[model samples]
Target: MLRSRVAAAGGCVAALGLAAALAAGAPASATDRTDPNDRYTAEEIHHFLEGFYGNHGPRPWEREHLVSDRLKERIAQTPGYDLLLCAQNEPRDIEVGEVTTAQSARVGWATITTHWSQSPRTAAFTAYVDLDGSRPLQLLDVDCAPGD
Candidate 1:
């Protein structure tokens, strides 16, 4: 459930935004679906990354248009704590931490602690969703380091 929500809000935004910008440059007959879900893929998520610098650096505009404070706040307001407690799939052994979300037009960021997985390794991740809300995917750095 955490993966689903985070992926939807984060990765989907970046992918959708890039899709929109690219779509405008393409011919009108382009067959790609505008829906964000259409672009979502595990592979895309695994390799896709927005650089922090350069011409195509991870600028704010790309992600700003795709996500909203309303959405993030709504997620923050969810009963995530409760879900972690009662959900059988969620490991009950470790103390869970508060959930937080960050947004750019092209991405959403989330970090939380869970006992189900190894320590520190899976504590946080960034989802890069396209502007169209297409199939957003979670991306971890190549070094297995946590993303900003």
Candidate 2:
């Protein structure tokens, strides 16, 4: 169960555009493309979060980007911290409310609303997606926060 959740969370991180952030050191693949929709799946969000909390690692989502070399060093020092903190634990439940898309010749953006659930508690968040949907769906970025 834990393994499945961790894999799901990793997949979610990859889906959430964090893969690009994490893959900063990886070589580019010929098959790699930047389309937000292709990269993000509504269902994947739930799985990712599930894995995040399940593992008890540091959270990339907790701090936005890896930032400077210092932060990267911190991240590296704490192996699997991000994955364990963010993917292994469950945050109650998630409700993807509505999704809206905006586009131009060069790029595109999507706004999605989601709800989070935990025993005796519930919260909401919104995600903003920017990527090249015309070619393939890849996450550019996301903004999320608690909602009422």
Candidate 3:
């Protein structure tokens, strides 16, 4: 009888162990996982823009990897001014505002404010970002704020 009881307890322990292992290996809930289609969240857009504007070394057009083909064409046509900041010269500091989703799920827009150290004036522009699933995030276009 004692041996049978010991065998039963061992069986129970083994079953419990198997259950725990299966539970541990189970996939996370749908909500916990990110959707591949919505990979580029608003926060990601803000970060990308912040990084792009923060680096003043390269011209917006020069960073072909970051700019879309359409934007590159626009830049080529419109010369002299920096299309990204919509300013003639690079700013001392760039403040990228909250990024919001546009009409399309794959597009986002943010207000980029450029501050110059030498002048009290500041320039603001609307930066359109393309969050293409097939490719990395790229700058779609830059529209200067009214009255420069």
Q: Rate the local accuracy (lDDT) of all candidates.
A: 0.36, 0.40, 0.75
Q: Pick the candidate with the highest lDDT.
A: 3
Q: After superposition, how far is residue 32 of candidate 3 from its true place, in Å?
A: 9.9
Over 4 Å off in model 1, which ranges?
A: 1-39, 46-48, 51-58, 68-124, 128-148
lDDT per residue (tens digit) for residues 26-57 in model 1: 55321253324433333333233322211222
List pairs with backbone clashes in candidate 3.
none
Give the lowest summed-lDDT range of ten residues in model 1. Answer: 49-58
Q: How many backbone clashes does candidate 2 have?
A: 32
What is the TM-score (0 to 1) of candidate 2?
A: 0.32
Q: What global local distance difference test value does model 3 have? A: 0.75
Error of 2 at 114 (Å): 6.7
* TM-score of every model versus the real structure: 0.24, 0.32, 0.67
How many collisions between residues are there in candidate 1? Answer: 34
